[model samples]
Structure formats: structure tokens, C-alpha cells
Target: MMELAHGNEVYTWPGEAFPLGASVKQNGVNFSLYSKDATRVTLHLFASADAASPQHSFELNPSIHKRGHYWFIFVGNIGHGQVYGFQVDGPWLPEKGLRFDKDKVLIDPYSQAICFGRNYSRERAIGPGRNMDASMKSIVVDQSDFDWQDVMAPRHSLNDTVIYEMHVGGFTKHPSSGVDKGKRGTFAGIIDKIPYLKEMGVTAVELMPVQQFDVNDAPQGRQNYWGYSPINFFAVHAGYSVENDPLAAINEFKTLVRELHRADIEVILDVVFNHTAEGDENGPTFCFKGLQNGAYYITDKETGNYANYSGCGNTCNANHSVLRRMIIDALHFWVTEMHVDGFRFDLASVLARDSNGHPMKEPPLLWTIDTDPILCSTKIIAEAWDAAGLYQVGSFIGDRWNEWNGKYRDDIRAFWRGDSGTVSRFASRVLGSPDI
Candidate 1:
């Protein structure tokens, strides 16, 4: 984005929509996206909601822009399903990685349809003093279009993947999952547990945090039973919606990711950008600390404050720069707006630290998400290590990240909890994670 943040304050009227989205131009709707590691960009217009909150807000740094790699702007008339997001700037200096932060309002990680939460509720996108959360705020959705009928996307392959990690409301919501009533744990209750995850063969379904998060976060004193606290990484979790609608929770989670990618199967999510649900500074003012608390976290450059590094207190100054375009617009909206295939990241060596946290063997945000060509083939996976101890584990330079080999989840939970050398370390982690 910027060396410190300012792509005309993020699209008051962005352009270059040959084939992108949100395009109703008689008055307004040109918005386009692609950061190429931002240095400047801006567009955080809001003015829709009322009884629930979210009215006439402002921000626009477009001066007829369009810098390389992608950062266009064109705020002429402004029309059609309006609600906006963008706030880029440059360099906050975490070593030399560049984090930018023109006062926080980011979220277009290639947004497919957002316009979501917290108006009548009081959290109002937090950050002023910690409201519940929706990470700086970025709604504007009116493009759900829904038509997936034939569906698609199981496309499995990290060695024919198997992943399972539950909790879309506790995978079916206990009570023997009789379902019915409240569609027990939604997305059509995982589309009725997708034939029980295709009869347990698994294939792939990772989801620990369907983006638009922030449930019960009181410093994890114990809320979000296990969502890993993320927020609007390009929307999705309107309380896991079975049908409460958020465009039916983005068309039943894109028809449950097009019926598990049309039987090929592959969803991996778990994100968390190492701290959000805005928990720090006494925890809760939301929206990256009131639109720019020292530019999205990791303080103490000398006591400016916050830098817990995933202790869950603060730590997401993700090298800052409009919080790294809100972490590359929430990973390009989970791979072009929730088509998803991979991303685990959680602490990921506190995303390669440096916001004064330290360790950075060369982490320019994990090497710009490992030579990102729109995240190469996606799948980065990390949870590498953080409660601040900094453990890369089996190494982590990243060119396309991978590492939940975490000593193979502690030797298969210590060999199915029995522990003793455990059947040759669980057959060397199923022949070393090819997941044999």
C-alpha cells in the first residue's frame, strides 16, 4: 500500500472495474480492489443504517488515483448499495516490512458482499473504547446474487487433505444433533453436516472462524467458545446463520462452499490475524483502536502501549500500514470472497513479529504472504507459535507457509492421550503429514 498509508484515503470513488464488483455508476458504484502490498489507498464511506446505527460517515483520498499493482479511485456520483471501506497509508517501520495505517477503516479483502453488524446493539463496531467488534467496520453488501444450484469446490489436494476442526456452533449444537429448531449450528447446519462430512473420509473443512467474528469476547474470559476471535475478514458469520439472513449468511455459506466444492472438498479458515475482537487497552474499543491507535496495534515502540503478541491482549500491529491493508484485505476476502482453500495463521510467529515484538528473520509479513500471486495457491497454514514465546517450529521462512506439523499436534495428542513413545510417534505423523 503506502510506505506509511494513503492511497487517497481509500477510494472515495475507485475505478478499474472491468470485471470486479459493486458497479452501479449513474451516481455511485465503481470500487475496485487489489493491493499488491499497498503504500496508499482510501475509501471508508458509510451512510446507510439508522435504527441500528451506521450513518453518514466519511473518508476519501482519491484524487483520481491508480498506482501500480492496483489501487484505483474515482468518486464521482456514488450510487447502488452504498457502504464502503478502505484506509491505507504507508510504513510504520517494523524493521522494514511496512504496515501502513491511515486511520484504520479497512475491509475489501476482495469483498463479495458484506454490509454487516452492530448498529442497534451498542458495540457499533467497537474501537472508541472497545465495542463488541467487526474490525473497523466494512459492510456494503447487496450482491449476494445466489444461484449456486450446481455448486462446486471440494478440489482437495494437500496430499488429498483430511482436516476436520469443528465448531460452527459446536458442530450441530449438541443435544444429539437432532437439528431442527434454529437449524442447530448453521450454514444449513453445515448443510446437514455434509453427509456427515462425506462419511468421515473428511477431505477438508477446517473452519474455526468464518471471518465476520467477535462472539462473546470479554478477553476470552470465555466467549466464542472457540472461534479464535477474528472480525469481518470480509464477512460471513452472522452468528453462523442457518437462515437468519445476511443474505442468508451469504447464500448459505456459498451453498456450503458449493456443496463442499462439488464433492471435491476443501475449506480451511482459522485466521485471527494474531489478536482482534479488539481485546486490549482494557480491551474493547474495537475497530483497530479507534481507527488508528498508533496504527493498528503492537505498541510500546517506547510505551505508546500494546504489544502482547497474541497473549490475546493486543499484538496485531501486523507491522501496521492500515494494518497491512487489514491483513491483505482479509486474505483477499478468503481467496476472492470466500471460495477459500487455506489459511490457518492464528499466531504465526505473531505474523513474523517486529512491531517491537522482535523476531523477524526476514518476515515482511511472512515474505508478503510468500511471494503472493494472489496468495499463490492459497494454503498458508501456521499457528506457528505465540503466547509470545516465539517458536517457529520446524522452521518458518514462508514462501507459501505450512506448519501445523506442530510436532504433529504434540505427537498426536501424545498418541491418543496414552503417551509413551506412542506407536512410533503415530507412524511418524502418518508418514510425515502426507496424512497417510
Candidate 2:
């Protein structure tokens, strides 16, 4: 507990802070961020979508910060989609492994829509709290909604499955795609073109990543390119939604699934739980790290620096219960609620790492997923290796999971390139599982 020399209410709080995001049980929203050496942190609230011009921003009284380094203040007056940024002030000592730049406006780790650019330089603010409603925090947008239609899980058997992996954008971005000019490359666009997908003989459509992420990271067209970096696991990409109403887009996605079910098609999500969009100390703070730094990441216990296991920079200590739950709930929501077929885990081996960065012989996370009753029928495909050089293709085959068979990618590339002996290796991959 940090005991101030003097008991003084540093700043007047408008309301209480809620956990994660605005919640029904929440009387206020909790504002949190990670900075091991940060001296001060302020929550800036904008009246409009303009961050350069905050309507009113204030620093929380130091007395309110919890042991977990969280600042809880009741912020009842603010509605959802309220553009916010964090200004953290601390030592800029990099050699000591700390990069605290108060000048750089940090994003809320839990932000649903990550606005582009550094600091106030833009007019449009993007982050999901709930700009669509002025309802009480109790009126929080249910990322998970109730549907009585049916609990139709896409049990796509192995031999029958023809997985068509494609980007939600690329498929429609091509002018020749013949998609509706308005609905091009959107969730609705995909739904609109589901018939074409059926016609192509694809039983399962494995999406790159529909999870909300920072497309703006590639705003200049440089590209975070592949949607490998995930921003919010729970929220679908706002840009991909057919309409501005994200909830409606979700319902429409569900409807698309229902329709596809009638036609016997499945939706597989390419999920990146190995790491997040938050690159490193250099990248912006979007979620888990901001919620709980040391807890959510595998920090160098000695130096308190983040470990980079997923190649994305900050390796999520996926073994952590809270973060692990976030990953699990996201998948469960996709499968049980949205009726998704399965998940292809990018960098599956990282999930096998313990919080301390050691590879566990039997990682609890992998085991639980393999045996989850709700996910028993779910098809699990692993990228099988990670950027950290943990290769487990045929090495780490678990029950009920399929490794991506990277060897297939290598051999197939060789064959298409007209390399010799490719035919024999291709036969083995086609005939059997990479399991052995």
C-alpha cells in the first residue's frame, strides 16, 4: 500500500471506475495502464471524437490507486465511445528497460476501436465502449447476446472439410470480385457472398482475424498487413462490420452462420492468442498490459521487463488466469454464441509457455482447451511453432488438435516451384496427419 505522507484527496472524482469496460454491475469505469516506472498517469476524456481537444481531463488522486496499480474513479457522466487516452509520466530510462514517454498518448488496452495516429493529431476517435447508447453502464453493449434460434455448432468432419482461408478484405477488395459496391469486404459483404462460397465447394471458411484490431497501424498502407495482431478479442472489427452498429453486425454474422448451417458450411477463425497488437514498450497500450502489467505479462522478475515470445514483441503470459480467461471466453463466445466452427491458433506453442517463460511439459492452457466439454467437437489447428523458435509441429501433437503441418507449406512451395522429390513428401502429407 502506498501511504502518502499526508492524507489529502488529490483530485475530485466525477464518478467511480468500472472494471474491463463499462459494465452493468459497474457504478463507474476503471481506468488502468501499465508503467513500472511511471510517476503519474492521467485519464483524458474527450467530449467529442476529438482527442487533441479533450472536453475535460483530470489526474486521479494518488490515494485511490489500488495495490495492483489501478485507478478507480466513478465516471458515471461519460457515455460509451467516449474517446480517451492516457498520459503516463515517468523515467525515460531505456537501458534499465523502461520507456515512459508522457508525450506519447497511450491507448486504453481495452479500447474496442483503436484510433489511428499519435496523440491528438486526428479528428475521428475510434474505441468501443458504447457510443450507440446513452444508457447506464448497466446498458453495456452485450458482446455476447442471447439467441434462442439454436445451439448449432459447426461439426465439420475432417475428410469432408475443404478449408478456404481468405481475408475478409482481400476477397472483396478485388474489383472483379463482383461484390456490391457498398458492402465490399465487410462482414455483411461476406454474408452477402455466402452463396458464392458454397458454390466454390468450401465447407469451412477460415477467416484471417475478424477480432477488433488496429488496421490504422497500416493506415499509410505500410501494413500490419496480416491481421495477426489482435486488439480486442471480444469485439469484432468495426471496419468489417456491415454497419456502424457493431452489435447489429454481430447479429448479422450470426444470421450468416445460421444460413450457412442450412447449406452445411462452417466458419473457422484464425486467432492470435500468442501475442497481441501491442508490439512492445514501443507499441501502444491497448488491453491486458494496461489492466495489469506484471500479472498479464511474463516480466523479467529481476528486471521487470516484458518477455517477447510471440514475435509481436509482448508475449502474453497466456498462462495467467485472467488473460487466459479472456482468451477462452472469446473463443467460447465465438463458438457457442456466434456458431463458429473452430479456431486455428497462431503460434500455438507460446500457449505452452509458463508465466516465467519456461515451456511446461503439460501446459494447463493447452490441456484445458483440448478437453473442454463445450469445445470437444471444436476443431483445433495450431500454427505449431512460435517466433521464439519453439518448434512443435509433430513434436507437440495433443488429442483432438491438428498442427498446421508447416512441412506441407514447405514441400508444397517446393513442388509448385518445380523442385524434385516434392511428389513423395506431398503424398505423405496428403495421406496422413502431421501427428506422427
Candidate 3:
């Protein structure tokens, strides 16, 4: 049993493993995580976001709390705004591709919200001891709390779409953007610019990685402003929210989508499922590396080193059964809960690779995304290449998937630059590039 801030005692129950991540129930919140090789798992509950240590910790017994590869527990009396994380103990054999650090307080892979405390440091998560004081924690969120106000997606067709690829912060961060000082460079700032987007005839706005990412993933003094270095797939980037609260990112992003939908414009996210912020082996153990490294990433069989298919230090094992499910689930959540109109996959060719980083004839993850019932109406665009030279531009898998035309872009640029013998190619590009 546990005591709450309200002075009520609540008991712990053996939670179900079907629905993953933290789920808020009527009685309490149920937490579930997948760690196939973990020998021991402990749940740490924080009193607040910046709490140096856990107010309470429960070591999950494999006999009762574990089902298959999932470990779950339900703590009554605790509901929304509960800050928590996991510490999984297993074999730490990096040569064989198991990098488990029980000392590190790992965030949930399916976290709906992440709370980066005042003491949170990315450096502390590397080559670590106990990083509870410097770690980012996950929050138990009640996803149903928000009122979307019956806003429906515009669902614009590709033929009629004029996409404006934009960075959320850069869109309104400038002093002359006219957005309020407090709301600048945030989801609220985007909401304030709906009129301008409508005036420009932009049918869809492809937002560049709004998913929660590590700002400290960049070099010594520089921060990662592009947001391609994702930390959590399900959570919206809290840094994009005007409010400091973790849940504010979720609701504020929803409000941005709702308001954009009202203005007859669609919201498309530039999703990076190819790689994560937890870079190569020497990088930080944020979430995936701490949970089950081999399962989440594509590692070299002989050396046990990370495979850099995405040229971003590591490549996600997208075709792995566990990761395949996660990618689909994230897409479903965005479509159903967040009301997103589409996804523009970054370095999408990486998703077409097999376990050993070989391009598959038919990758399961791409097929799953192509046929996902919830995403049947959602627009799906692929960059059609990886940084490691795996190009699938003209032959990208799946019937519904759209590929970004690099040939057309280059040809058009050459023609306008007065390059000789570029007329035929330019004419072909004008007629939708049939030659490609």
C-alpha cells in the first residue's frame, strides 16, 4: 500500500500487460514495460518532477508482475501527474549487445509525457552510476482529459496539397513574428499564425519532428534545435509547449491541431523513426538502450556494434517485431488521439531494411503502416532514402506511400540556373517526371 498527497492509502495490484506504457484507470494508474532479458525491475515514483530521489520504490516480482516479456504493476491512489521511471537489471555484456544499466533511471518507451527536471543532465546518463537525480522521468497522463471540441481533419488530397515544410520554433521565434513574447517559438505560436498559413494557400504543414527529443544531443555548447533526435516517440516535445508542465505539451499540440483543422489546413509531422537521440554505443542511455538494446536497434552480429544505416550514429531495427508494433502504435495514437492528418517519414528507407541492415523485398513495418486501418485516410510520405545510401525513390514499397521526388527538385533547380541541355528534363519534371 502507498500513501498519497491527499493522505489516502492505496494498494498495489498485479497489472495486466496487454496495453503497454502507463495507463490511467478509474482506481489508479497501471504501468507496463517490455524488457525481454531483464532479471529484475524496480518502479520508482517521484514526489515531484525535480525530486532528487523516489518517494517510494517497488521492486516488481517476476512471479506476479511479469507476463511474458512485460512487467507491470498497478498502484492505487496515484492518478495523473505522477512522475515515475524504471530501473531494469540484466546482463551488461556490450560485446554481445546487452547494455543494461540498473543504475540509470530509464524513461518509458511509450511515455505520453516526459518531465525533464531542473537537475536533468544528458551527460549524467552516459557511463553512469545512479542518475535518478539527473534523469528525465515519465508522467502518468490521462489522455482523455482534453476536450478537442469536435474538430475534424481537413484530409486534403495530394493533388491539391501545397506543403509548407516548417520548423515549429523557427516559424514564430523571430522578434517580428508578432506572436506574444510568452507564446513565441511554441505550439501556441503556431496557433497564432493560422491566418498567415491560410493566406498563403498552404494545404498542409509538415512539422519537422514535434516528438520529444533531447535538446542536449548536439555538440558541446550547441543545442539540438532541429528536433530529429527523438527521445520518446509517443510524447510531444515539451520544449515546444508554452507551459512548463509536461502535460501541457500534449494538450497544447492537440489545440494546435484542432485550430489548424478549423482553418481547413492539415497537420503533417516529419517523423524520425529511423534513429533516436540515444546515439551510438558511447551515447546516453535515455530509454531504448536502457530497456532492451538489441531488440530496439540493429546491431552488427559479429562486433555487436550499432549499424549506422540512418547515418545518425545508429539505426532503429524497424522490422523487429517489437519495434514494428511500436511504430504502428505511435502512428495510431497520433491519428486517433492527436487528430494528425498525416506523416512525412524522415530517412524512411531505413524502415525497409532487415535485421542485419539488408534491404528486404517486403519490409513488415512499412507494410503495416501502409495497411493500418486507423491510418487508411492519413497521408503517408517517405523521404525514400537513408544516409547510408539505401535509395528507394522510384521503387519505395507499399501502394499508398508517396515518395519525395529528389530528381524533380534537382532537375528544376538546374533548369532555372541556366544549365545547358536541361530543357528536356525540366519539361519532364513539369509533366510530373514520368522519366524517373
Candidate 4:
């Protein structure tokens, strides 16, 4: 086993590379990251969330620590709540689509929880230079620590489901929400409003993107109010948690899900697997772009420019082998661990595109999610369209996947407005859009 000393403490172990994230074990915490083209990988350990510098940094020797494209290490002393990040060294050739900045501290792609330090600066990550102090760090979490209370999801059928779409923060952030002072705009606040939802006869709550997203990913002087621009899929957004503790969001979100299930209300996450917060080539490198830019995102072969199918700057290469696996793993984690009832994929048609950005007849990622045993019983809803106008409402792949009928919404609105030739279309829409 490899050994590293930090002050008087010595940490040692050769970590496993199977589980892609930081996993807590009896020995210590095992960290594994994937970088197909990276030459060197350095792991940085921080003393605290806002620490100006790393307490210790280890440069993994590829001969020993690397197994294929994965770099892994097990620290003997550290377990839960450990803050860490990575710095990968490789070719910085944007023309060839390889953006690897050794100076920037990149979070784990499979981070269960993230720590945004006081010095965290999205601007600093945009340009060059070291972003260790200014970058967000990933925290090690013991997933087994929480007691789910054996609460199960009340999976309501689509025919009987009355879904209420709401944003977690905006639902109770205002004073008029009547939520407790400290608990307002948090997962705990959602629990307090459960009784109101039950009264409304709402069977399910389709929450806007609750995954950890980049709030700074908006225009200049503006913030990303909506939680659509996600950073990490596995971690819950920390802003919606009551405490600043790194692990608070995880446990609190679990509690919210458990409580909602107890009230016989299902939780459906509006997931954004189409794109990431890391925008185009000029955007910041948080995780995916820094690790393997070419693999994570679909880019132009000649110019190396990102495919803007997501209309949010860059489109995720969901059909790629690595990304397909990561997406499936994320879904599995939410269903098995978080106990969520369903997922509403935002711009899901983007997942239908091939590696070259053309629509595929049968995308591998969608099929995997459809056939996965863990997600077989879980509800799956697709937006059935992308920003680039690849509409597949009636033709969306997967027999089990239900699509959001955009035609029904449009025709119903037109009929209500008393538009021309609306009577015939309106009749079909009210009858469940049989004409569609």
C-alpha cells in the first residue's frame, strides 16, 4: 500500500476503482476519478470548507495508483465529512478538445455532497491560474448513517397522478409561506408544507432541479434562480439545506423524501441530464470539462466547439459509454438510496442524440434506464424535445417511458383563447389527445 504523511499523521492504502466516487469504508475513504486522456492526477485534502489552501496533496504515480483511466487512493485516517478535490495535468489543446488545467481544483463527478467555500469564485474558475481556494470542494459522506425509518414511496400511477410542479426554494422562501424562520426555503420547509399539499389532493410533487447546480451560472449581475444548470447529479443543492454542514443536504433531503412518502405523496425530480453548468469553451471547468472534456460533452470534430443542442451552451454526450454509465448510476443512486418515486427529464430528447449530434433510432442511455432493474418500477417521464427542435413526443424511444404531451398543452391553450380552427383540435385534446 502507498503511504503519505501529513504533519504527524500517516495515511495509507491502495484504493479500489470500481465505485467511481468517494466511498466511506471501515479502513478509510476511497476516492476514484476518471480521466481518459489525463497524464497526471493530484488529490487535494482540505482542513475545512473555506480553507485557503489544501492541508495535504498527493500526486498519484500512474504506475501504482492508476488502473486504466481511473486514479484511485484510500486514506487510512479520513472517513466521513472529508473535503477534497482533484487537479489533473494534460494537454491544454482546445482545438483537439482536451481541456486539462492542472491549476484548477476539480470536484469528483460522482460527489455525493459538495462544499462551496466562502472564497469560492465562479469567475476565478473561468480564466486560468490556480482555483484551489476559490473552487468548490467535494465532501466525503457516509451514506449508511441516515435512518430512512423504512418509509416507502407511494408510487401513484400516471392515470391517477395529480402532479404539482414546484421549486423547493421558492415554495417557502417568502415570509408569507408561514414556514418557521430558520427553516424557510429549505428541504425542512417542504416538510412543513406537506399538510397543505395533502389538502390540495396532490398525489405527487415534481420538484424543479434539486441537484447541486451553479447559482452563479447566469448573465452578468444576475443569478441562476432556477435550479436547471446542474453541477453534480449525485449531490443535493446545499442552498436548500438549513445548515452549512457538508452532510446536512444529503440527510435533510432524505428526510424530506421520507416525510413526503409517509403522507402518501410521491417526489419526482425534474432532472437535467441534457447539459451541465460548464457552458461552452469559454466557460468554467468544475468537474466534467476539467477531467475529460471530449468524453463528457459532444463537441465538433474539426473545430472542437461544443454542440449547443441543450441551448444552455453545451450538450452532454449521453450516448458516450462513460456518460451513459454515469447517468445510469446517478438514477440508481436516487431511487435506491434517496427513495425518489420518479424523474422528469428536462430536455430529455437530447439524450436521444448520437455521439455525432444526430438523432439516433435507439439511444443506449434511454434503453438502459428503461431496462434497469432498479428503475423498472420507478416512474420515468421525458420532455420529448430538445432546444435544437428534435421533437419526439409520439416517437420517443422506450416502451415504458411516458412523455410530457406538449401538443395537448398547446392545443388546449389555443382552444381557450378561441383561436381559428381550434374546435376540432380542442375536442381531441380533452379526450386525452387521441389525434396525437
lDDT of 3 by residue, 67-128 (tens): 99999998888898999999999998776668999999999999999989889899999995
Greater lDDT among 1 and 3 belongs to: 3
Q: What are the per-residue Cα lDDT tens digits for candidate 4 across 1-436?
A: 3786566474857788979999888867888999989999989899888987988788888887889898898877787888999999999887677989988989999998998888889989987798887899999888887898888789778889999999998999999999998999899999999999999999999999999987889988998989899997999999889994558888899999999999999999999999999999889989998899888899998888899999999999999999999999999999988999999999999999998899999899999988889999889999999999899888889979999999999999998998999999888888887765
Please give, for residues 1-436, the per-residue lDDT of candidate 1 as tens digits.
1222244333243356343334555444566655445556556556642212333333333444554445554454555445666666655553333334554455554454444444433243333322212433444455436676755565556876888886787789876877776788887777776777888898888878776665566433556667677653566776788655444577677777778888777878888887776665555443344334565567775545576868777777676555676687568766775677778877788877776778878877778888878877767888788896777767878656777767677788889889786888788787875442
Q: What's the distance in Å from true for residue 89, model 4?
A: 0.4
Question: What is the per-residue lDDT of model 2 for residues 209-309, given as tens digits with 9 covering 90 to 100?
Answer: 87766655555546555788776676666566667444555666676667777677888899988777666655554444443565566767666667898
Q: Looking at candidate 3, what is the lDDT of residue 214? A: 82
Instruction: Score every model by TM-score.
Output: 0.32, 0.75, 0.97, 0.97
Summed backbone clashes in each candidate are: 67, 18, 0, 0
Off by over 4 Å in 4: 4-8, 417-421
Deviation in angstroms for 202 in model 2?
Answer: 2.1
Better of 1 and 2 by TM-score: 2
Off by over 4 Å in 1: 1-139, 150-161, 164-202, 205-232, 235-256, 259-261, 264-266, 275-298, 305-314, 317-345, 348-384, 390-405, 409-436
Runs off by more than 4 Å, candidate 3: 1-7, 419-421
| Candidate 4 lDDT score at position 262 | 96
Q: Provide the RMSD of all predictions against the true structure, rounded to 1 decimal.
A: 18.7, 7.0, 1.9, 1.6
> Model 1 reaches what TM-score against the true structure?
0.32
